[model samples]
Target chain A: MYICLMYSKEIVKGTLKPIVLKLLKEHGRMYGYEITQNVKALTEGKIQITEGALYPLLHKLQAEGVLQTESEKMGKRVRKYYKLSQSGEAVADDLISEMLDFMQTLKSVLNPDYGQA
Target chain B: MYICLMYSKEIVKGTLKPIVLKLLKEHGRMYGYEITQNVKALTEGKIQITEGALYPLLHKLQAEGVLQTESEKMGKRVRKYYKLSQSGEAVADDLISEMLDFMQTLKSVLNPDYGQA
Candidate 1:
């Protein structure tokens, strides 16, 4: 099961930061589980953002000042929600643009019909 | 100059293997310099594959049995050209498919009009 996911994992790892930022931008704020579930649902179970990969990225974004977190008590447990900071919003936009450009380049490369090579 | 390329480098680093494989699949055999130039030309100088990044990946692919190399003397210098092996061809196909799927997922995520949240 896990072995089958190697390719997806590699692709996701590269785009994870932008994906998280884009989600945060759209939703305003999202907790870890919500983020993971949203991604799973959006990708139709083809891509799963595991806790192991998600937490460190969240932490890294927080460290980089691209994300801010708010913790709210949900009964006995605390739910930490993440949202993009001002700089994060700018970063998200830049990331999306960069990703789009990259996809375009890749599309040209992948589709020889484009005759780019 | 180098700083302007940070985003592009990050994106390219993630997709380099597939890009290289695709290029090899199309061209049959290519030397390191030729591969680098091809990528630079294809991306319109937006992405540059530095020697530092390209060599290790090529070696890794060869070690994984996904690439085979042939050395020929071009004047006084020996030029190494790489091509996909049998397993390499299969891997290249899988990688291209995976990359395409990834781009689709990214397109949906990046496009707010998609309402994919």
Candidate 2:
């Protein structure tokens, strides 16, 4: 089995929102760059959250009231941090549960003996 | 945690291709309705593959040369069965491996202690 370190863009794209929400929930607040770096470090470079996918998702979450942003002055640049809103906290919980269930379904589909006794 | 019996359509949509490919690889060939019923039965009704999503995927796979269709006549109806082509066998292996890796990534994201000893 050839298990590559890098994942296909489509697979990463589908899971991006829940991944972002979960990361923010765990760490409280994170900027865009930090989220990307954290994901890369945690996945050991198996997954890379690209700017094209991350920024738009953050903006969409903000527009949907699931995330709120705060800006801080860092030397000569402004760093924007994202945190889950009250409703977003609820959404994060739901997304985590949903993803977990989805993973189980994937397991059963891939491995016939996954849930078999 | 409300783990509903039905998964969100979006999650199912993202995973449909690999699921279909794997099923075809495992069972040799299957028709549209049979595929849906097998998934429902295997997942214990947790996931449902809808026609709206399944047909277009089958057609796309056929057009892409990954799947070949055979029409068999049974009484008053002609049932179309799908089987993986030669290239599709290789693709199926790749997809299964990719899905497994992707599930591992999801595990690490959803559970921080996943890869920790």
Candidate 3:
């Protein structure tokens, strides 16, 4: 039985950071599972951030100074919560603003009814 | 010139590639000047992507197989045109869909009026 998987690797490579940064930017802080669940809920099961992809992104974010981690004991497992760093907050604002602008530009180009490109 | 700039480096570092990818994802293909001009037009002068940064990203995207380039001679400049590669198209779809989902998740967390985080 071939279980056709949906999320492709190339997509993950390109978008992992922005998605993760955007998450930390808004939520203040969240554990690994929480991030995954948030993505699942928002995407309505159409999109998911796998552990393999999510953890590495968290680590990279920490390395880049865009994220920080705190430990919280949740029952048995001590979960590491990811949050935005001081620099991360500034980044979030810039990213969100730029993206919104990009969306408008894209709408103009991709869906010409929005605006003439 | 104590020209206080709006686009901070941290913001640029965090958002550079996604913004570029998002741009290429929407517009079929465009050159360096066009990309800068496109960003300017959409941003209404609020955001500007410099050539130093833009070229490196275009080169990196090409390296990553998410973009392919063709040369177009316009007046004195032989501009390189970037389009989604075979994988880039799949990557773009996945990136766009995933980002929209992430945006919803972020709205719930940041805005709260959208949904519960």
TM-score of 1: 0.89
- The model with the greater lDDT, 2 or 3, is 2
Best-performing candidate as measured by DockQ: 2
lDDT of 1 by residue, A21-71 (tens): 888999999999999999888777767888998899999999999999999
Error of 2 at B97 (Å): 1.1
Evaluation by lDDT, superior candidate among 1 and 3: 1
lDDT of 3 by residue, B21-101 (tens): 677777788777888898777655546788898898788889999999999787997878998898988866656555444
- Output the number of the lDDT-best candidate: 2
iRMSD value for model 1: 4.6
**What number of clashing residue pairs does each candidate have, in the order they appear?**
0, 0, 0
**Could you give candidate 1's per-residue lDDT for residues B1-117 as a string of tens digits?**
122343455666578888899999999999999999998887677778889889999999999999999999999999999999998999998878888767766788777575243
Name model 2 segments beyond 4 Å from true.
Answer: A115-117, B115-117
Order the numbered candidates by lDDT, best leading.
2, 1, 3
* Residue A92 local lDDT, model 2: 92
Task: Give one digit per residue, the lDDT tens place, for model 3 in A17-113.
Answer: 5566677776799888999898677545545778988888788878999888899887998989889989989877666555444434434433345
Model 2 Cα lDDT, one tens digit per residue, A45-89: 988998998999999999999999999999999999999999999
Go through the candidates in order and give each one's C-alpha lDDT.
0.82, 0.87, 0.65
